[model samples]
Structure formats: C-alpha cells, structure tokens
Target: MSADQSVAIVDDDDFFRKALERVFHSAGFRTESFAAAEAFLASYIPKDEACIILDLRMPRLGGLELLDRLKERGIDVPVIIYTGNADVPVTVQAMQAGAYAVVEKPLSSELLITRVRAAITDARARRTRRNQSASARAKLKLLTEREIEVARHLTEGLSSPEMADLLGISPRTVDAHRANLLRKLEIRSIAALARLFVLTELGDS
Candidate 1:
C-alpha cells in the first residue's frame, strides 16, 4: 500500500470508531474517522481512500445506501461493512451493492487487521489498473488517423505488408505509420501495444 493511502472509518458509535482508529494506527495504517456516513461522503476524496470500514447500522444514510451513492459517483474503493447482526438477507444485500466484505460486529482485532490489509492491497491494484488505462487512452488520443489504424492492425496481429494491403497503402508506408504510432504511444513492442489496446478497451470491438 502507498504510504499516503488511508482507511476511512464510518460509524456512528464514537467509542467503536475511536478504537478502530487506534488499532489501525498501531498497525502502521493511517485512518480517517467520520461519525456518520453523511459526513464521510461529504468530504470523501476518491484517490486518497484505500478502503472504507463502514458500520452497517447508522443514522440517516446507512451503509448499503452509502454504497449506492459511491456507485453512482463511480468510486470503486473497497468497502468492508460491519453490523451487529449480519443476517443472511442483509449480507446478501450488501454484497449485491458491492460491499467488498461483510463482517459481524465485535470483530476480533486480528481478523479486522487482516481483512483491512487485504482490502488495501486490492484497492492499490485497482488504482494501478485505472492509472494504466487512463495513460493508455491519453497516449492513444495523440495518434493520427492513419497511425491509429496501423495500431489496430498491429494489435490484430497483422503483418506490415498485410496491413498495407488491407489499408490500400504500400508496405513501407504502413511500416512508417506503425513506427510512428509505437513512438507516440511510447510502447516498444507489438505485444505491449496490444496490451495497451486492451487497457483502453479499444480491442473489444
């Protein structure tokens, strides 16, 4: 996990929330606590959040409702919800709403820490993928129309001569376009270029 990444604890219980903050701090994790879900959402920063430790039973905006709000805003931060009684129906509902994990209340400190570490690791992986996809899409926007066509052909495993034949251009011209696109995208190999296409979702069609 990044040094600056932090866990956001949303619980209405003052004592429980404070205890969780101390536990996370002792385990070398930074924590931000909110007395209510509304407050957490009001000041939430998507990029800084490694995970959310949420209390399911809260006043006003409950944990499941907050999950819906996060989804509406397209925030994919991992959320671990804890409730006094995690009944089957409620647990199913939370899972359907994209809660990363659901745990019962009075959770053991060791178990909480272990799950938190896993959630943070997952969040970091997700953030890295999002960054890579954004970078690939931005670099692709710098390519010329012809270069983009060549890039698509390269991803499709077409040889320079084959692409040239399909594109109604000479093999030498196709090679030039291919080289230019590779340079513009800052990718050195066809395999890497293909992976970039996958990242940008340009290969789906």
Candidate 2:
C-alpha cells in the first residue's frame, strides 16, 4: 500500500475502531476512523483510500444501506464489512450488495491484515481498469459517427463490402472510414480497434 493510501474504519464501537486503527498502523497502514456511517459519508472522498472496514449494524444507515448509497453515487471503493453475528443470509446479502468481504467479530489481527492487503490489491486493479476504460472512451469520442459505425462493424467481423451494403454506402467510403478509425484511435489493426471498443464498453456497467 502507498504511504498516502489509508484504510477507512467506520464502526460505532469506539474501542474497536481505535483498536483497528492501531492494528493498521502497526501493519504500516494509515487509517481514518469514523464513529458512524453518516459522518464518514459526509467527509469521505473516494480517492487515496485503500478500502473501507464497515460495521454491519449501525444506527441510522446500516452497512447494507450505506453500501446501496455508495452504489447509487457510483463510488467504487472496496468495502470489507464486519459483524458480531455473520449469519448466512446476511453474508449473502452483503456480498450481493458489493461488500468485498465479510468477517465475524473478534477478528484475528493477522487475518485482518491479510484480508486488507488483498482488498487493497483488488481495489488497485479496479482503479486501473476504470482508468483504462475512461481513456478508451476519450479516444472513442474523437471518431466521427460514420467512423464509429465502421469500427463497430469491424468488431462484428464484417467485411467492408458487407458493411457498405448494410449501411447503404459504397465500399470505398466504408474503407475510408475504417482507415480514419485506425488513425484517430492510433491503432494498427482491426483487432486493436475491437479491443478498444470493448474497453470503452466496459464502463457502461
């Protein structure tokens, strides 16, 4: 983990939250602690955060509801939730709602450290993918409408003549648009163009 990246500990238990902060510090991680979910939500920005350690049972906005709120806001920070009683249904629901991992209370320090390290690694990978997708979308925006259509057809494995027939344009014009797509996207081959299209589409979900 980077020195600037801090783990966010959101739990109502002051003692436990402090203990977690200490543990993270001992493990060479910086931490930000909150006594309540609402307080954390109010001040938290998504950047420079490694992951969130959320308590499952809070007063107003519970862990699950907080997860939903994060999703609504399109925050992609990985969250690892802890609970005193982690039953099957609740664990399933938490996982479905985008909790990175669920752990029962009385967590071992070593286990916590290991899981947090893995979560941070996963969060970095997700950030990289999002950055790549954004770059792909920006590059795609430089293409004209006809060039975009040609790129789509290229991904579909359509020949220039076939795309021209379907688009009601001459094959020569289709080839021109294809060449322009390659130039504007700075790609050499049709395969790279297809990959760029897929990368741009990854952010849609």
Candidate 3:
C-alpha cells in the first residue's frame, strides 16, 4: 500500500472510535472515524485503495446496509467488520456479504492492526489489478489490427527483423511499429510490454 492509503472507521461509540483512531494513527495509518455509517458513506469516496473498519450495528444505514450499497455500486474497498455482537448468523452474513474479516469487539490492538494492514494490502492488490486491466484495455483500444498482430509477435520474443520477415515488411517498418506499440501501450521496455500482454491474455481468458 502507498503512504496515502486511508482507513475509515465507522463506530457510533465515541470513546472507542477515538481509541481506535489513535491506535491506527500510532500504527502509521492515515485514519478517519465517523460516528455513524451515513456520515462515513456521505463523506468518503468509494476508493478501492482504501479499507473500511465498520461497526456491525449502527443507527441509520448500518454496516450491513453500507456493504450492500458498496456491492451494488461495484465498489470493491475491503471491509473489516468489528462489533461486540458475535451472533453466528451475523458473522456468517458479514462473511457472505464479502467482508474481508469480521472482528469481535473489545478489540485487541495488535490483532486489529494486523487485520487492518492485511485488508489494506488486499485492497491495494485489487486496485492494482483493476488499474492494470483498465490500462491493458486502453492499449488494446489504441491498437490497429496490424499493431495487435505485431504485439502478439513481440510478446513471443520476436525481434524486429524477425517480425518484419514474418509480416513481409521492412525491418525499419517493423521498428516503427514497435516504437508505436511502446507509446500506445504506455510501457517503456519489452518486459513491461510482455507483462501487459500477459494481463490482456488473462483478462480474455
């Protein structure tokens, strides 16, 4: 995760919120607390890079409702539910609703920190994968039919001379196509391009 990653905590209890905020701050996370789920939802953007620490029960727009809204919107921020309510059905529901973890309250500082870090890490990984997919799609959009063919060959470790021979073009033309490929793909080197190609292939699959 980047230094700017945020963790939003939504708990109605004032003292607990402050304590958790302090703990998260001490653990080197940029933390924000909201007394209500509605306040947090209204104030915060649904950024995939951020993680949410939500109280399972709240006044209006409870954590479960908030999670439902997030899912409906296709927002994939990781959620860690923390609540004193340890009912089996509630825990099972939270997990089924796609919460990263459901933590029981009277929260252990060490355990909370560890879970938050892991959730943030998971969120960051998901965000990175989504961004890569978007980038690959953008690059694919920029490609002409010929360029797509060239890119496929490039991923196969074909040299410009070899590509030129295969495509019945001059080596200079192949070099030009390769340069265009790099710019269109927004990648610097063959390795990066190859990685993009792999991602594209995986996305297709």
The candidate scoring highest on lDDT is 2
What is the clash count for each candidate, in the order shown?
0, 0, 0
17-51, model 3: which lDDT tens digit per residue? 99988888887778889999778767877765578
Error of 2 at 131 (Å): 2.2
Between 1 and 2, whose lDDT is larger? 2
lDDT for model 2 comes to 0.88
lDDT, residue 92, model 3? 96
TM-score, one value per model: 0.81, 0.85, 0.68
State in Å the error of residue 166, model 1: 2.0
Candidate 2 residue-wise lDDT, 1-205, digit = tens: 5476678999999999999999988888878899998998899888635889999999998999999999998888889999998999999999999999999998899998888888888777777777889999999999988888889999899998999999999999998998888998888988888888778766644
What is the C-alpha lDDT profile of model 1 across 1-205, one tens digit per residue? 4356678899999999999998888877778999998899889887544889899989889999999999999887899998898999999999999998999988898898889888878766677777888888888899998898988888899998899899999999998998788777777998998888788863222
Instruction: List runs of model 2 lying over 4 Å from the truth.
Output: 72-74
RMSD of every candidate to native, in Å, equals: 3.2, 2.4, 4.7
Q: How displaced is residue 190 in candidate 1, in Å? A: 1.8
Q: Rank the candidates by TM-score, best first.
A: 2, 1, 3
What would the TM-score be for candidate 1 when compared with the true structure? 0.81
Cα error, residue 164 of model 2, in Å, equals 3.3
Better of 1 and 3 by lDDT: 1
